[model samples]
Target: MDMRLEVVLLPVADVDRAKQFYAQRMGFRLDVDKPVKDDYRVVHLTPPGSGCSIAFGVGVTTAEPGSVQGLQLVVTDIERARDQLIEGGVDVSEIFHDATGLFHHAGEVDRVPGLAAGRASYGSFASFADPDGNGWLLQEITERLPGR
Candidate 1:
């Protein structure tokens, strides 16, 4: 069997705010943002150059709005990634490294599954959220990452 990522569903209480954050702040392209019903809206956004997009709305319930726990979008250069988010007015953290390598930051990060005993990667990254607290990790892997 073979599989590839197609889309992700993010939960947010305020669709408009979530949409704005992704589009205006994160540079995600607004692929869809329209009314599905009264007081309900569906918003979809894709990274600047990505095939996958994240879907969010007011009524969907895969997870509670602002309840998205851990989501990481890996990149090649974390510093540049963090800079872009900062330029967009998003709050970020200082860069740090560990055994695995180096990493930036993301909402309260826990040990990623299968990471070495006490190693972190070097990449300027950080955590930020949507209106409802859907957390995200914008990471940049400077050296060879585990999965790569």
Candidate 2:
């Protein structure tokens, strides 16, 4: 079986605003923006260097706006990624790492105030949200775990 995850449909109060935030602020590539029906619009976007894409627009999802969370993007250099987002007008959080050497705690718990020594894989993170409050996390993982 060749199952692969593709697009993530995000819900937003305003389609144009969310499109601007993702395309302008976060620098995601705007792949498609077209109206299919009188009440339906589809906007597709992809992050830089990413295989997966995200879609959101009118009539696309029934989920509440700003309700999605914990979406993650893996990066090789956490600090550089954070700085780029900050420069792009995003209010990114400070770099931090998990203390237990396993994984991070959710929502500001178990966070130490620095990147892990040697920039170990799966050790550091920074987070930010879209204008609609859909949360996204940047996790530094220079190497994948065995079999991953």
| Candidate 2, poorest ten consecutive residues by summed lDDT | 99-108
**Root-mean-square deviation per candidate:** 5.0, 1.1
Q: How badly does each model clash, as a count of residue pairs?
A: 15, 0
lDDT of 1 by residue, 45-137 (tens): 899777788998877666878787557777666667888888998776554433234442234344343332333344334556666777777
Candidate topping lDDT: 2
Top candidate when judged by TM-score against the true structure: 2
Task: Predict model 1's lDDT versus the native.
Answer: 0.68
TM-score of each: 0.74, 0.95
lDDT of each: 0.68, 0.91
Candidate 1: stretches off by over 4 Å: 98-125, 142-148
Off by over 4 Å in 2: none
